[model samples]
Target: MTSDPTVEPGPLARSSAVTVTLLAPVARFSLRARAGDLAALSGALGLDLPQKIGDRAAAGAVEALCLGPDEWHILAPEADAGRLAAAAAAVYDAAPHSLTDISDREVTVMVEGPAAAELLTIGCPRDIDRIAPGRGCRTVMDGVTVLLWRDGPERFRLDIWRSFAPHVIALLRTGCVELATCS
Candidate 1:
């Protein structure tokens, strides 16, 4: 490893009020289905696919976020990828749908602690405080599209494209310092 003083650790930031960290690897899927296929699809995948945009559903270790009436973003433990994919495909016998594996296309950025919402607002135009826990929506941060999930009043996660991660991290790093200093 190079002894570059400018290079910092992987965590986006960690301070008194908040902790921004990159989540461990997880399997991700972009699922699309017709209105009638929701039930069958959910049964096959073991997670209820929400019907309303921004709604989230969870079953054990799996979670699904409804980004649109016909589209969902699915997340699960990394080792479950192949098994989950096979299950989703089995639905093809009765319900015609699409499930594209997207595990490598993005990474999860988790912002936790009391200042989570406020930190997000640094680059997000929407009022972060309004996004209720258990729900998520497709939004932009610093012009990059992100799947914003509010896990609680003090915890949130942003699913960001891998290519834009560095840019996002830098902005957040600065935000964390500023927030701490301002507090």
Candidate 2:
């Protein structure tokens, strides 16, 4: 898998929006569980789940979050995503749960640096800072549902649907440039 400069760096992709600077190459994994098996499945997987998947990922080790009643989206380093998925499948496959590898189905953008929070505020309405570290939330940004993770004081992970990822990136990039030129 040669790197595609057009695709950005890391496991995420750079936003097409020139205003918002985005980190590249997000590794996305989707976990599917049987009805009523979310707790045991999560416990068996040993993930200290936060109140919300996206919010909890900000607590350091985590990279991104997604939510569903019997499903969750876990984003991490592309290289490690397969490992996590495989581990989960092995442990839960026989336990009446199903885990699918949807790493390629979405786009992940890591927004960081001094202006990350401010940049995100342009698209997200939630009080991002109040979200607390290590927690995630569901919100619409630039007309797309996103999984938001507060990676740090100025860092956040934004996961959007693959189809809408480019639009979000473009908008953010535009915001970044506009903000930069303003200040």
Candidate 3:
């Protein structure tokens, strides 16, 4: 048997202490705006957009993470794509910012367990332990750009580009075994 890169991958890592699975589809957007425009956009989107790097705010099924001084990554239920775009569009005139729908460009991988943070450090450049819970940062894993979300002390969500997912998942699975043995 042979593997084909063109074909999308199936399941990812799974373990008792650490697991990696692809989350169900969600609507994602890359928003770029100035500080003064955040209030208006947040009102329209129904969620406040964090301004400081690594900060995050959420409302309902929607969450906005401040990835930079003027950039944010928004995630919401897939069904809310139209509603989100419409709301942002409505605010464009007043806020004058960019909200690009990036739902299809990347996929969410949830990595959670007692050793989740250590597992991530295998390839991630940052000291994963340093990120405060409920915050996120744009970082690199095995040279791949990823948005690392620290949902809790033991839970993480990696928003990674689809093309590099296979490589990243493979690394994580191998790390799971390494950590499992060290226990």
RMSD of every prediction: 3.0, 4.7, 2.9
15-129: candidate 2 lDDT, tens digit per residue: 3332233455556666666555655655655564434444343323434354755556666666766666666666664556656667665666778767677788888888877
TM-score winner, 2 or 3:
3
User: Which lDDT tens digits does candidate 1 get at residues 83-159?
Assistant: 99999888898989999999888878889998888899999998888889999999999999999999988999888
Worst 10 residues of 1 by lDDT: 1-10
* Candidate 3 lDDT, 1-183, residue by residue in tens: 114332244446666788877777789999999999989999999988888899999998899999989999999998999999999899898899999999888878889999899899999989888999999999999999999999999999999887787778778889988988888
RMSD of 3: 2.9
TM-score on alpha carbons, each prediction:
0.93, 0.71, 0.93
TM-score of 2: 0.71
The Cα error of candidate 3 at residue 36, in Å, is 1.2
Candidate 1, position 171, lDDT = 84
Candidate with more favorable, higher TM-score: 1 or 2: 1
**Deviation of model 3 at 169, angstroms:** 0.6
Can you give the lDDT of residue 56 in candidate 3? 95
lDDT of 2: 0.62
